[model samples]
Target: MKKYLKNYIWVILFVIFSIGSYFIGFKPGLVIYSNFNEFFLEMISFIPFLFIIIGLFDVWVPKEALEKHIGKESGVKGIFLVILLAMLQAGPLYGAFPVAYILCKKGASVRNIFIYLGAFSSMKLPMLGIEIGYLGIKFTVLRTLIALPLFILVGYMMEKIVGSNFKVEEVKT
Candidate 1:
């Protein structure tokens, strides 16, 4: 019971705050609660499907394939591949973490994992269309051109800081 309470303390606090606001007629608290509720619901709707896809990827793709494609010695090819994968993926940035974790577990380099995360956050293909529609082709192209190199640099720096011998530990369910 204590462990469960500790794990869910934030949720309990949120519920208490929401109820307290309702009783006190606090408009800002009520609005925050409403927004939180909507966001929570939205996440719940897609998280299950995301996990299912991640599970399939974990099972179907072999470690050797990942190592050959995106491991420490994969070089520029790995960077480009990870960027392409990041761009092709569609979802909120939070969704990328699970995929990145799986990639790490499967033998992907730290550099490639960071590159994947950076690109996924900024350069998703699905978001590009919307960005172009609002910001025009020139701006979008320029931003992407600038972002790509920065992402690579950041990845490189992170890899150096984290070291080549870094490894992800398996988590038991």
Candidate 2:
């Protein structure tokens, strides 16, 4: 109980704030409620499907295969592969964390993982269609071409600064 409570204190505080806002007036409270409801609905519709895919990926793909393809020695091929994978994915930014964790555990390089995350956050494939529709194909293409190199640069810089062996740090009580 204590562990759960400690983990969720922010949620509890947010709930309290929401309730207080409700009592104070509708403009703030009702707006918050409506936004929360919309976001929750979207999350419910999207996140489960993503989690199922991640679970299957975790179970089906062998660590050795991941290592061979995306490990430290995989070179430029690994960078391109990771970017392609990230672009192909659908879901919120939060969905990337589990996939990143799995990749790290399975021996993917830190630089490639960082590149994957940068692409995932900035350049989703599905969103490109919408971007081209609204912003024009030239604009979309230019943005992607520019961002790809920057993301790769960031990945390399991060790896250089943090070292390749960086792993998820455990939280202590």
Clashes of 2: 0
Q: What's the CA error at residue 56 for candidate 2, in Å? A: 18
Please estimate how well model 1 matches the true structure, expressed as its whole-model Cα lDDT. 0.81
Clashing pairs in 2: none
Model 1 over residues 1-173: C-alpha lDDT tens digits?
Answer: 99999999999998999999999999999999999988788667655665575556556645444344887778899988888778766789988877878888777899899999999999986677556655778999999999999999999998899896676554544
Q: Which 10 successive residues of model 2 have the least lDDT summed?
A: 59-68
* Candidate 1 regions with alpha-carbon error over 4 angstroms: 1-68, 168-173
**Candidate 2 Cα misplacement greater than 4 A, ranges:** 1-68, 169-173
- State the lDDT at 150 in candidate 2: 97
TM-score of each: 0.59, 0.59
After TM-score superposition, what is the CA distance of residue 99 in candidate 2 from its true location, in Å?
0.9
The lDDT values for all models are: 0.81, 0.79
